[model samples]
Target: MTPLSRTCRRLQDSLNSFSNTFIFIFTTSHVRTSLTPTSSTPNSLLNAALITTYPPLKLQNRKPFEAQIDDSLEQPKPIEETAFDALKPTRLPSNVPLYSMGSSSSPSHTIPVVSTFANPFETSNSIDASSSIRKPISLWPGMYHSPVTNALWEARSSTFERLLDPPLDAPPQSELLTKTPLQSRTSVLYNFSTDYILREQYRDPWNEFRIGKLLEDLDALAGTISVKHCTDDDNMTRPVLLVTASVDKMVLKKPIRVDIDLKIVGAVIWVGRSSIEIQIEVTQSTEESSDTSDEIALTANFTFVARDYKTGKSAPVNRISPETDKEKLLWEEADERNKHRKRKRECKREVENGKVDDRLEALLAEGRVFCDMPTLANRDSILSRDTRLENSLICQPQQRNIHGRIFGGWLMNRAFELAFSTAYAFAGAVPYFLEVDHVDFLRPVDVGGFLRLKSSVLYTELENPQKPLINIEVVAHIMRPELRSSEVSNTFYFTFTIRPEAMKDGLKIRNVVPATEEEALHILERMDA
Candidate 1:
């Protein structure tokens, strides 16, 4: 070979060696420190370690060796170059708080001042350095923001504050409007697999993604969608107050992995004169290819009631005009759900008024038989009271929503965890979440109030022996000691099932019998529903 060609060949080989070394150093440092397995390491972390090690090797081969050599000769670049130059950590001023956008002179260092939710009307020059108000940072489209951020933003907004407490004489209908569903559609992306800091914020001790955290995000997104649907202008003086009325259902279609990027998409599906229904879906793409279709991980429906901020009465919201067939179908489904909710409410009233159908009567009679004649009851069955588990704590400000009330999603998360524990204790196996049968936000919980959560494995279905279903109920009560009062704040029903693998140990769940007429009524009601 010619001297020039030989020289080029040597350079190419050296470059290849350098690239490989670089990849090794980068992967080893990050994976060793961040992805190291602990005693409590989850399966997902193991998979993440494997993924982190191999992907960069393929990156080195993106361009041909000859091409790289030609580029190197033209540029005469240094040998110790790195791909992470853009990622060099910024060293902020010593006075500036990390992860905070607060005033440097502010006395308080506890609460972070996130700029994403800062008051839109306030400029940096106009901000009072001595003020303790937490401002929001600018957020780009598709970026993920926590529920706290949303709350802070709302707290800082003059428009939202007006909505929260408007002038008593303010008109209920400042404007009437209609909007297409697409106009309010939003998608928030969580790049957990790629973003280290983001992953750390959401990663649980088990190295898995925290579903509770995601629930908070979902609620935040739903609230955003509701507000988007209600407002036509960015600078509205009298925006309507929207509060979560209920979470109709939340179904887990697939397990969410921490190593995968997640996208949460939501939009207003249907709107009544004073209510809105939103659909939120969580999806994840496979690591193998971004072009591959995303797998849906979860789906949920959130209902919000719009009220006049001044009068504290139901207020009309902008109607949604379905533009696409899918949108129309979603609207229809939401309508059906609305009808179902009404029917269920009427049924509940009937049961309360001592009116019952034949099927319900039969189920109630069967429940009485088990309660009245314990000796004649099946030996494999256990009283529902036996499957009960409970926990209580004071609701703190950290769990409050934009309205200053405890967030519905936080309540759901707490109830879900307790329900899972209840089922696990009853089944003696790790239970997989099936779905949230229903969630009722009967009363708003106050921060600093005594909150009690009671969970019970209401019943078990063994029709599918391989995957026995456990129906669990959780009741959240707000208690006041001074008045000796206890009122139900929320009701959550969740369904879980044992995996076939878990059932291989010859484990069988016993049927649960109602011990009282009240318990019997609950069982019959659920069965009828």
Candidate 2:
């Protein structure tokens, strides 16, 4: 054999051995491996490409890449927390019976067993034995109690529960047949000056107190006062059930500031056999002084009706006796209001029956004249339709009260917001809340129902050149599309005015005129109110 032939054989053998080693290492390891030319390998393989292999990368307990990307994109934004969130019940009581509208009668139910005066702000560990034994806090003649929880919302619910289950140990009906107005008098103080957290709850964006919140508290307070008058004992375990029927008027006499302390005093001014008339006054301490001499900021009147808890029939309430001259005057005023309400109801029924009174007929005539002649003098008069605004939403369970009905306060807040918007749009300036003339809850709203609020500038008073008053009416309806039914749930009347500062640019507010006879009648009704 030749020497050159032997060397060629040796080179071929070396190349074959190197290739086998590279393949073995690549297949055996679970990680990436690369085979490059080394000093022991042939020089011809130095410039050749390197052999490399990589195993598939795996992550423990992870979603697919596409799924991860989708999840990141679909994540919801965080919601902001508000002070009112605490007012919501953490969980509903399992024992409370749910009322069904379709049912012939309410199912027999019992009140849940719980503390009568549990302080929601205190935890179990913080509540001492002495505190638990303390006398029930009395707001007035009849102290309010809650079964499930002690939140203000629950306190309101206690009154509703009484409508279904009255206390069995109530006093005899003949014992406390009469109650003085002073006996039902009560006052609640909201010390915003020291309680920063409470102030935030009632404060608006402009640092002023929210009148909508005030309206809610006022309704609750009035209901409490009514219960106080009807029940003779402080325990409030009476066989009478009282609920708010209507709010006659709520007038804002002055602007309310959130920085100062506020006080609400209310009493049962008068009572019928089954109805109660309450007067609530809101006052605020003067910012300049530390004394208790507060000035009146607002006044409201509410009417409530009582019913027998078990029979669900009209129940008589204790008669209110007037002692002081002030009390006598209030009683007289309430009597007049009651008479006026009856007359108004009759007039409404007559109009609904297509019988228009002479006053309403005259107003309709004026509306026709305004519509027929749109001359230069009356050019600023716009039709009510042109000054209208509306919004709608589905009522949610979160908006429900303890009785499973939509809360009255929630309705008032929504109506006021829509009215404010209507006034702002009509005036071409930011409108300031002046007063809530009247609110009527004709029917209760249900959860999951479609609610629509329609607001319009009912009329305008340009008596003052600097500031013009805009009267807005908001009508809320529960629309059931499936049933092809739309029912009016509430009617709200609010008055707003453009501040002099907002009208400094010489913006003139156009007068609102009714376009139809119905609208004309509504205008006249408000005028009378």
Candidate 3:
């Protein structure tokens, strides 16, 4: 070989040796320290580590070696590895060198080595990788995915996620790292896009979005808004758990079409001692439409209560002050709602204490409308009712939330569907959703418990025969095995507008007759309220 060719070969060999050494040094020296999230580490220390280890490959000095290799010989394959891959834990191959920062007696400074293929069932309690640990991802077949790596990615993404508006170009990292009070305290805007009607798994050839799915998104948004409101500029307070207490005055105005952008704006409208009311407004827009207007498709007021993570007691949050006329009105409205809730609680306690007034008793004695059969054997009563329906089922895991319980919105969806069926059968027409008067979550429903839902017509206005106003009541009960009885968990009130002209045949409706004073009083209480 010529002298030039021999020199080129020597340079390529030296380059390969340097590449291997560089990978080994970083992988062994720093992998353990970087296993945990960098968020917990000091910013200066993290910056120093990044500066020391970044760009392991020096590409600027490559041109001399790049042209020296003969075209006839096979070129070396480019290194497709990344710095992140070195951080991934894998089983120690036993032949690999055991690394340490100092002697064994001074173990505090040792560089801990961990395997990527740790047991999936083992629990990791500490961020210190100094002591090797963990569990198998799962026992089921094909369920051995690495949760450790997944968690690391999630932590990294959340810490560095973009915080600016979508349309605006992102600023430099230096600008983004310096967060301001205004950035911390801002209304959260959530945008979700889906071709709901065209996707086979998500849709059923329906043009409008599913009420259940929409409600789930709303519940999630409510929690997000609550967190955003409760968060402070200091970052001293950690995120607290918030539960949905009630949903009121949810009005579905227009049908949300397929392949549309469902935009939601959620903000804290009112705050009480420990509970906050978030107003979530949903609007539907599409890329094809020229209408830049924001038309609300649905809107609801959701009340949530923050709970201390450790004590599980009601936690106080920062109070909000109204600055604008609209804000003042919402604040007053929320105050009124809080007062109403307090009054209802007091009334319930009064009834439990046997301090019922004579006026309430008199309302019970008056002839009131009810839909329940007088007796289980009363076939005539069942046949006469046209606007009542009942169904029962066991709550399964599929309907459960991360809290391991059935979601409030799932119950609402069930109630709405049953009520719509009853209304459709009675009116002999298509029932259009108007509004949800109230969805009071009295108690949490267990995942595996028997859920019994009863939907009945509370009131119907026949003054306008063509267009009738119907109010439906839905009550959910969970069967208590130990007590041998069912306890009420939730009550949903829905209002719908239906047209009698849409009926195929002439359908005659019969008025509901109350079988007992208690049932009559219950119906009357809802109607009067």
Candidate 4:
């Protein structure tokens, strides 16, 4: 036998020996009473053992022995020290009749002996399973216990088994977008690296990887990076909530194919008092290496904010100092972007109050040099030839996050899908995702709310008719059924490139048509911004 098998055999033999020794002392009195006074008692107890094998004598109205067992045996001990106790019955209820060992084997008079020797060499797997068996180690409540092996894993971070058999209360996949950062005294940063192939399952009708899935991953990665940047050694650093504030300058350079290994990496580029900017880069390679020959597929910048998990108030984060030249450049750019964003907000407020600045009015004039060129008028003329597309749906529970609200990724997906459809129809051929210049999530959408997504061809460049480029605007609004009103939730700006056609002679392209001056100005403002 193998050493393990031998050891198990020895352990079983010891358990049987211990049980027989313990039970022998308790049943000796009953054995002695079975012998008649005329019988000669053997000095060696071999005779007593022989007598126990015989049929028990009937005693009319005689009560069974009520022997009191010492409580010392019941005291808790280490599993190794009290292994034999596993063989004993846990409860001895009064309703079960106790049988004498010295009983007949006949059907009417048979008495069952709790046999330790009969199964001494039997396989351990043959033992009947019962909850009464003492566990070698105790586990916390709600943890799973195996019936076959009686083994358990550590509760912390052990979601592998639970994932296989998920409970109804488990959080949706979107809830994993942001995870708590590991506590550390080192530099505050996050690095995300994941590889994906353009599998058929992730493709759209055109057999290209869906831009929505890419955006979803980007949102999740950005959220994780934000959480990592916000955490520090401060005792007040509670679990912080993070959300995607904006996605900017996301460019897709090449079409992703099923054969290419798409590698995406994300890292914290800059941090503000309560905001974090994460730069995520997507690259494709024929082979796994650090070779420069690898193709650059896409690049994106994402902004996220740390908020109080409970009150939803903005929370401050630790500052990051730039050490590298690239970091320094990005830090400066982040500051400039923040300033420009503030100025844009102020400009919007001025426009909303019907107080346009002289400079803006000059920029909007009918005809002059660059300062007085009627850009809005040109934008309106271009929008006069395009078709608009729209889609709407009621938010469902499946799209909800752990917070019981629609996930930002899901909203981005809906918007991107509609935008793709609009671009495809306008291009008269397959349109590939080129870039998402900007996407801003304005407000959270509650579950069961009506979601309206509108897409339009904001601009198109067909100067090179062989290769046309189209820009689309996708807007999301949440509608309240009771109020009969809708509030804007998101605005997505996307750019797409149509497949090149062999045009011996150039083809004239149709343009987007905006009817109102407000629409024209809105398009012009975004272009300038």
The candidate that achieves the highest lDDT relative to the unseen native structure: 1
Sort every candidate by TM-score, greatest first.
Answer: 1, 2, 4, 3
Give all candidates' CA lDDT scores.
Answer: 0.71, 0.68, 0.56, 0.57
Q: Tell how far residue 288 is off in model 4, in angstroms.
A: 14
| Best-matching candidate per TM-score | 1
TM-score for each predicted model, relative to the true structure: 0.68, 0.65, 0.56, 0.56
Name the lDDT of candidate 1: 0.71
Instruction: Put down candidate 1 lDDT per residue, 241-271, tens digits, no spaces.
Output: 7889988767887778787788889999999
Better of 1 and 2 by TM-score: 1
Residue 88 alpha-carbon offset, candidate 2, angstroms: 27
lDDT of 2 by residue, 418-457 (tens): 8877887777777889888767778878889899999988
Off by more than 4 A, model 1:
1-125, 128-173, 200-209, 232-236, 287-294, 353-379
Among all windows of ten consecutive residues in candidate 1, which has the lowest summed lDDT? Answer: 64-73
The TM-score obtained by model 2 is 0.65
| Predicted candidate 4 versus true structure: per-residue lDDT over 1-529, tens digit per residue | 9644564565456446543343333343323233343445443343344334334434554345433333334555556756555554333332333444222321332246652222334455533222233211122111221110112122211321222123334322222222222221112111212223225536567666667866766664555455455544233224555677887777776676644445666677677767877777776664544675446677778888867654668866656766668768877887888788889889877777876445444333332222244453554234422458899899886565434567676778778888888887875666778888777778889889899998888866667667667788888888887998999999998888766552334433455545455665665666655
Report each candidate's C-alpha RMSD, comma-separated, in the order given: 17.2, 17.2, 21.4, 24.2
